[model samples]
Target chain A: MHPAPSVIFFSVLSGAGFGLLTLLGFGARATSQGWPAFVFFAVGFVLAVGGLLSATLHLANPKNAIYSFSQWRTSWLSREGISAVAALSLMGLYAALIIFFDIRVAPLGYVAGALCLFTVFTTAMIYTQIKAVPRWHQPLATPALFLSYALTGGALLAGAVAHAGFLFLLTALIQLWHWNGGDKAFRNAGTNMNTATGLKGAVRQFESPHTGDNYLLKEMVYVVGRKHAFKLRIIALLFAALIPSFMMLGEVKHLGALIAVALYFTGTFASRWLFFAEAEHVVGLYYGKR
Target chain B: MTALPETTQTKLGLVIDLDTCVGCHACVVSCKGWNTENYGAPLSDMDPYGQAEGTFLNRVHSYEVVPDLGTAQTVHFPKSCLHCEDAPCVTVCPTGASYKRTEDGIVLVNEDACMGCGLCAWACPYGARELDQAAGVMKKCTLCVDRIYNENLPEEDREPACVRTCPAGARHFGDLGDPDSDVSQLVAERGGIDLMPEQGTKPTNKYLPPRPKDTLDTDIDVLGPLLAPVAEQPKGFLGWLDRALEKL
Candidate 1:
């Protein structure tokens, strides 16, 4: 529930990067070989790889991160790491063939595109699988929203403004739905102080275990003021959805795409912050914080 | 390796009594003291003299419970890892660092493999795991794995430090898997309950609920007859003094 900056950035930037890679692998022509093609692919690689690297920043022990891919059979985070690496590697090879030798292996491109989307799904599952946070446990809440954002942002960067406009509007609706349902998720989770302590009565926390802050409080008991969150929601809708949707749909060509991309990133960043901040972890019930 | 074993050979856990825990937090201190020196890494304090933030495997919380038929009562709840049969913390570990031992059903974090991503802590509903800020690894109640199996220590000292240090004898350590075990029998007799059973983790540890209190009637004065006067008027010398005062 802590709106950690590194994780927020990682989610937003990597989602966008994978989205861009998906479009490039599927839509780009075999003859497309030059600085423009290189530049586009370069942007995708930087965003994806840079975002992945930023995730390591939050790790208290980064030295052991190499072993993270070992548990893919059961761990969503492990699957995510493996999926991202595989997607990136395959996409890298696909890009190299076209960029250097002008060879388009159509099948390779298709497979890479599918892998790109799968990587995003794995990333989304990392949050969705956590039943401790009821808001994120919903399939429509995290997985749908993440995929929608990635596609919309990807379309915009790929210069498919018309497609991007429609996707942006769809993503906005999903974001609204997520917020509407997430507000009641914790209360409806059937977890309270009574259930937490297994006491058959109206139980109230008389005293916490410690006098000062602990890791659980800092990590899982974030409180965002309702008024500030409301204001931020409006800002996110206007920039991430409304503004971009209007510009892209109207077919404004004079630097419109560039401006829309920038605004969309800012908007998604704000929403991503709320994603972590608004979530209520079940552990909060034990502390009488939920 | 993150996958849980089908069944553990033994379920070694604790049985805590809510009625007996006095909120003294001796168990918390004893656990911290023993774990810091013996475990994978020392439980470090960020600001010992100031804010005093530190890692602790076990903690005691006090709760005020107001029953429908009785007066409010204070209950001291000492919490640590329940070492659930289906431990989510183990499955959520990206590395094979977190595991539930099939031998004794103890959940442990391998400090050497832990990246300290804090995902295991997030997955735990009970807030059992804490990321040690100094060691940069996840830490939790190992159920004193080192002490329990060590042949060097005295036989009586084989239990967990918290169970050994509990002043009120509120804590009990034994195999909860066997139906005939002392802890299992205690659970059967006292109706020991699991914390958040709806979560369906099937926790190994059990908690005995506090007994009902304030059953006596407040309106009835049981001591009134004993304090009542022996005579309606003053006796002997006091009676003469009263008559003289009346004449005046």
Candidate 2:
């Protein structure tokens, strides 16, 4: 569970982007048309697309990314790619109709909004479906946390400060729950060195296959100290939830909202890093790591 | 195409004998050598002379097992792709690159289609797949698909490199799908077990558990009579010498 920067940025940024797009599709009014609408939609597009582009950085051969859209029937990653593209395309069209033609297609907006949320769900499923990592295998918690982050971030950007504050608190609670449950997920996964090796008694790894690190060790067996994780959790909560929540709830004006957004982004970034770093892959049991 | 086939015509896998592995990594080396040259992508090395990290399709791990009733035993566990019946690695591939052959039941990665997103590696519970840093594609044990089906070499040489190179005869390769197959019978006889059955991947590969140790009776010495004197005094010339020495 390597806390890869590209994936972290991709998930957090795109989650927020889709969240904003979902709001725009469903809540665009007459007064919010033209230049203002264009600006908001533009930001959404940049964040969504740019986040996707960053995700390609995680791929060693991104040139073959086009093929990634072909396996939606089985692969959550494929479903995610298709869903994101569909959501973005539909939202882009919906935005154009409202921003340029000054026409609001209610049905299109509703469909696009639903698709946007579905895209986030698919993105979350990419992690959730992995049985190897018990912490990320939460069918409910993983998606809930992702959606909460999206909605809260989206609400803040849409200037619904009160709504954003409420959502932020909810998200913080979910984050706490996820972290608390994740701490014990691996131990409770029923996988140990004995089960991994199918040995009768207490099994300990006497010798590893390689003297140096391998891809499996590097990618899945990443170890973060508990003390550092605790400190980062505090930082994540303080910036991502408490500070932003209080600021927005207190009806902070223009400058304060922008600062809140920055702080929230920083916090979400830390949270996303922990999402990967703390996850224990079952393969580690074979190595006697977990 | 990432969807698994309902049933494979044949389940070809390995039956590894843990009792006889001897902790020698010859299979690991032979697998690397054969696969690097023959497979879709050469198993690459990052710092061969210095760090010495490289991609290996097969690896041998040694474990110290302390049984409740017996002395601790060292077991050599050689691991590679199990080629599960319901292979998660295949299903998790965003591209149709990872797939199980409906014909032979061998799971393989189409290097041409692989984007190296590494979702497949993440999905595998056994840590079977490895992303080649140099080729930018996922690599795993193909069960020697090329060698097994190829009519190019001698018939006797048509097995996985690891199985062929195992000096201890710990590795057996054949169709496990057929109950009458040699490997299947070996598994049946030896009470071979899957790696992690709880995961429910339904792995095709099986490992023969190490035989129980310290079963011999240590209290009674079988060599006691052989080490004891044949007579109370000494026999023949030794008796005469003992008597003369006693007189002196």
For every candidate, what share of the true interface contacts is present?
0.86, 0.83
Per-residue lDDT tens digits for candidate 1, residues B1-248, read 98999998799999999999999999999999999989799989999999999999999999999888768889999999999998889999999999999989999999999999999998888999999999999999999998999899999899999999998999999999999999999999989999987677889999999865645656657888888868879979999999999999
Looking at model 1 chain B, which ten-residue stretch has the lowest summed lDDT?
B211-220
Off by over 4 Å in 1: A28-31, A224-226, B214-220, B224-248
**B9-124 in candidate 2: lDDT tens per residue?**
69999999999999789999999999988968899999989988989999899899998886888999999999999998999999899999998899999999999999999999
Tens-digit lDDT track of model 2 for A1-290: 99898999999999888888888888743368899989988888888888999999999988888999999899889999999999998998999998889988888988998898899898899899998999998888899989988887888787777688898899899999899888888777787787789899889999988899999998999986544888899989999888898887576888998998999899999898999988989998878885
> Using TM-score as the measure, which candidate wins?
2
lDDT of 1 at A196: 90
Candidate lDDT scores, in order, read: 0.90, 0.90
What is each candidate's DockQ, to 2 decimals?
0.73, 0.77
